[model samples]
Target: MKNKLKEIFYAGLIILVALTLGLAPVTQKEIFSLKWKNLGLQLVEAGVIDQEKFENLYTARGGLSESDKEMLYGRNNRDFKITPENSGMALHMLWAFGLANKNPILEDGPMMDPRYGGAENFASTGGWTLAKGSTMDHYSMHSFVTLTDDEQALVEKVSKGIFRPCCKNSTFFPDCNHGMAMLGLLELMASQGATEDEMNQKAQEVNSLWFPQVEKKSAGCAA
Candidate 1:
């Protein structure tokens, strides 16, 4: 009976994960109604992206909703959604967020692993081309988001649970850009009061956007 129950539980868990990925169109539709204005200002203050540079880059891209403009300038709250059209930008934005957000994970965590030579040498830190200076200038040095002790603990816990397809390690060991970006997303969600379950759900959604092909295949098997 115990073995049977274990199998049943595993089956349910697989189905849930599969369905979540299978319904990507629906699950990925989640929109984050966070204060993106603050995030933008944080990015600028941290030198993650210069204001002039951001304007030039956005304009060159050629599509800006009035809402997008507000996210850049106004203090209004903003809604963010991940789609194929904008996933790359979202990754960059999240990368900046992860870099600037004040968290112990980046400072004393696996990012400091001696095997990587130094934190700044990794893709998460080194690959950031949009920064005004060396990416190390902002690496976990800015107080972009102030989390309470509880929130910090929550972010740390959730980050360990998330993994990106590009790396075998979890976000806690963010050696690559995707892992770091996911760490930033997890921090933002925790600071904004996302519960553990909500954080996990959002992580999966972001991961799906980042790796749709992989998500589709895994989702197909149990769906």
Candidate 2:
């Protein structure tokens, strides 16, 4: 009986995961009311988010440089880490988006690559209209992101790696998926005030891809 029970449990788990990924159309049809909560849960299911993975993404992006400083966007040099406690809910919402068969081309892109527009990018373009009607409130979910100090440092790095110094300053807003998400978070954080520990922590997150450390000549004014 114990063995049978175990098998049943495993089968049930598999079914749940499948349904999570498969029934996206049905699941997403009712996302507006809850918004961020729905997104956070979905991000948890997709490999794209979670505490550890979020931190790793920041680390993977590297740090800022000289040329990065020359640009308006790269000047911020602050941290906007993607921590589980903060951006978890938002990312889960993003996960459900790509699965919804909306913009398969852009929705399902490389998370680490700035050019690889994902749910965040789609939200920047269609979150309010195109994507909103089909799935969760993409804008609200993106706004739900919250980052920790360490994660902010990671954001500084990743922002530089993908967003580039010439892009939008290494701050949270990059005019893409992450960018929109960053903007949403900023709006949410605004009420908390810039002096707040978390908001202040964001100021230090820098991926200065334009500073003296980097060979600016390589992509000088590439944008």
Candidate 3:
């Protein structure tokens, strides 16, 4: 009878552990089966990407970028469709939604998703919240719309001259370029309770400090 009880208790514990693993953040079940391409289609439904823009972005680099796109797009299709499972896909999806209608989707999405390293900051049990908020869409648009063609050519010229030995390419995220740093600073400032007025003042400073050549980078980027 004692041995039988021990066996039953052990079986229960195993079941509990199995359930926990299945529900883990990046488990095989969570990470795989993410409908990334379908999520892209959802962005289309949300009108985040118009047909022209969608085609442009979809065929922009032709399966050659250093980023995960090449690996992600197999002949079958996006085998990994991230749900609320992983932070990376969550961020991208929220970005798509935020980009739509110029809404503060990140706040409603990622900032509320309990992922993408947000627990240490906004929406956590106790972090920070300021009047100045950031949207991932804004960050993306800031880079996209700004930097006119000439400026892009110029920046590309500069980028080529300055070899980022650390950055394996534009996609190697570890490389601390000006753009990434700007986003980080923006997040920090927003969480620090800085007002838009205060942000305007500091925005000028940050643009000069970070993106020296990109004048008025915040023109329509900030909300």
Which model scores highest in lDDT? 1
lDDT string for model 1 (1-223, tens) is 9999999999999889888888423544543445465676658766887777777777788855565555545555556666665677778778888877778998899888888799888888888777897878878888877889999899888777676666667888877888888888888778778899888777776677887766533211121
Estimate candidate 1's alpha-carbon lDDT, on a 0 to 1 scale.
Answer: 0.74
Across 1-223, the per-residue lDDT of candidate 2 in tens digits comes to: 9999999999999889988888524522211111223333343343223435443544465532232211112323233333322243343233333333122122223332567444434444443232324333432233234455544444344334333343443323343444434433433344333333444334223112113243333211233
Residue-wise C-alpha lDDT for candidate 3, range 108-220, written one tens digit per residue: 43334555464224221121111123323232332212333443333333222222222322211212333233233233333344444553444344334333344444322
**Candidate 2, after superposition: displacement of residue 65 in Å?**
36
For candidate 2, the lDDT comes to 0.36
Global lDDT scores for all candidate models: 0.74, 0.36, 0.35
What's the lDDT for residue 95 in model 3?
34
Candidate closest to the true structure, highest TM-score: 1
Error of 3 at 65 (Å): 11
* Order of models, best TM-score first: 1, 2, 3
lDDT order of candidates, top first: 1, 2, 3
Local lDDT at 141 for model 1: 82
